[model samples]
Target: MNITVVGTGYVGLVTGIAFAEVGHEVICLDVDEIKVAKLRQGNTPIYEPGLESYLIRNIEANRLAFTTVPTQAFAEADVIFIAVGTPERKDGSADLSYIEAACRTVAEEIRHSTVVVIKSTVPVGTNECLETMMNTISLHSIHVVSVPEFLREGQALSDTFQADRIVIGAQDAHSSELVRSIYEPFERPIFLTDRRSAELIKYGANAFLATKISFINEIANLCDELGANVDDVASGMGMDQRIGRSFLRAGIGYGGSCFPKDTKALVQIAGDVTHDFKLLKSVIEVNNTQRHRLVAMAKAHFGSLIGLRVAVLGLSFKPNTDDMREAASLVIIDELLESGAHVVAYDPVAQSQAKRILSPTVEYANSVTEAIDQADACLLVTEWDEIVDTPVDVYCKLMKNPVLFDGRNCYSLDEVKQSTLTYYSIGRNDIIHAYT
Candidate 1:
């Protein structure tokens, strides 16, 4: 199967490479010639584990190729994937400029009776709009299909190969068959539906996940106020078969490319139809508020953070990826600096991107221990492995007041009990303020 994937972003590159790995001939297209050149030379623009190696292997094996010319790539391809970016607009709607542009390009470029699949996350009715646009543009039959990707950043490769399910949406049975054939190698259960449902499914999934994070964060706050341990509360609730355990961990809220934008877009879309999605609206509100929860907690610990040296452990939204799109660490860093606290941060892979965003305003530490040593207090914003495993006593020996605020609850109360320092975390109420 010869597949042409447009837009060499995270989704496009990952999707293209994964297909090529499974013995499909793939030509990855990008408008940016520089990016195409870099990808051709085996230089991945993003930091996804196993992606670079996989891309290199496929490229070396002649299964995967990169180019800026979509028409040239799409000429021989049976499946053309529109994996472009649909960045969020200021009004909280998904800006479909890239999607429109990609569809137009595919419509004009496609020579065969091709299936143009939308792999990008778009609002409902987007696939229908593309199908109409393509029909108007081409004399030959071009079927537009909505095939939304559910790939997580760090585990994208594994997720794509072993996807829980594949959603294939098309207007007619012919287009749907072509879409399924393209994904036949995946061996996953395929959910065949109308285009609108497929589009809504992507948004719905992200919004629900975001809502869960917000709900737990709200619970974490309540625990903090009522002197209850959120960890136990979460555990107790998760034991129920209904809740089961993913995305229930209360932390500094979700901050990634998908959740923040998708939740906002869904809320705006609902408002357009005069439907008030109050729950989703609150989900966004709760997540935005949760970002600053650590800041408020920090302020409470030290009356005025002015001139205080604060250490921020972890800079990425979540661990295992170097994407800082909507990372909570950015909010925490800004708040700390705003309150006149000097912020030192560390992340294994995201430090370079963090440096670009954070710049000289905050100090970038070489390692987790380096960030925490001699700081007035430390906040574990993102629960990275290195930060979680750091010795709590190290801060006890180095800082004037060894205080630890566990935003992700990376440390147990018992672990911090032995140290001659202050420990505050979400939900566990047993460890009261030993000092003050």
Candidate 2:
């Protein structure tokens, strides 16, 4: 199969590469000339484990290519995947302008019958609307299917090949089967549904996962109040087959490309139909509030952060990815900046990206020890192995004053207990507040 993937973001890049890995001829199309040039030379613009290696390998095998020319990408395609970004609007709805542009480009480029798959996360009814637009504008018969992607940034390629299920949404059997054949090589379960259900499935899955994260954070809050450990609470709750343990690990909050954007979109989706989604609303509220938990802990410890030198251990939304979209670090660091704390952040792979988003006053560090060295306090934001695996005693040894505020609960109680460092973590009874 010759597959043309339009857009070289996380989803598109991974999807195109994964298909090429499975013996399909794949061309990834992007508007950015520099990015296309880099990708052609086997340099991926984004970081995902084993993706660049796969890109290099597939290009070497003559199965993968990158291009900025729309006609060239579309001319040789058995199917086209619109994996462009649908950024969030201020009103909590998904802005479909990118997908609209991609569809328009598809209309202008493709010359024959094409199976157009919508791999971008879009609102329901979007695929149908796009199909109508394509048919009306183009001479070619256009079949738009919704096969929304669910790739986590850190584990993108692995998730693509090892996904539990592959969903195909199309009106006609031909387009649906063609889409299925693309994923059949992976041997994952293929779920065939109409366009709307498949679109809803993506949003619904992300919204539910966000709800789980918010729910656990709420439990963690209660644990803080009742002096009960959230870890034990989550463990007890997750043992139930009904409430399995996936997003049960409580932390500051979930912030990446999907959860924050999709949950808000889901809420907006319900509100558009005059139905209020109160639970998900609270979930968003809880997550927004969760980022401030560490800051609140900081204020409680020190009456004023007017001139404190604080070391932030991680910057990316999570480990293994440089993406900081809606990251908890953004919120936390913003609050810290406003409070007059001098912040030095350290992330192995994200510092370069974080520098663009963080305040100019915020400093960058090469390593965990460098970030924590001579700082007054430390906050563990992302649970990067570089930050977590560092000895807990390093904080006591390096910091001018060893005050650790752990947002992700990266270190065990035993690890911090033996150290003279003042440790404060979420929903844990083992906080050593040695700083009176």
Q: Which stretches of candidate 1 lie over 4 Å from their true place?
A: 434-436
Per-model TM against the reference: 0.97, 0.98
**lDDT by residue for model 2 (1-436), tens:** 9999999998999999999999999999999999999999999899888888999999999999999999899988999998999889999999999999999999988989989999999888999999999888899999999998888889987789899788899999998888898899999989999999999999999989999999999888878877788888999999999999889998899998899999999999988889899998999999999999888889889888889999998889999999999999999999999999999999999888887878889999889999999999888999998888999888899999899998887778877787798888888863555222
RMSD of 2: 1.3
Question: lDDT values of the candidates?
Answer: 0.87, 0.90
| Model 1: per-residue Cα lDDT over 131-153, one tens digit each | 88888997777778999999998
Off by over 4 Å in 2: 430-436
TM-score top scorer: 2
RMSD list, candidates in order:
1.5, 1.3
Instruction: Score candidate 1 by TM-score against the native.
Output: 0.97
Query: What's the C-alpha lDDT at position 128 in model 1?
Result: 85
What residue pairs clash in candidate 1, if any at all?
229-427, 229-428, 230-427
lDDT score of model 2? Answer: 0.90
Clashes of each: 3, 0
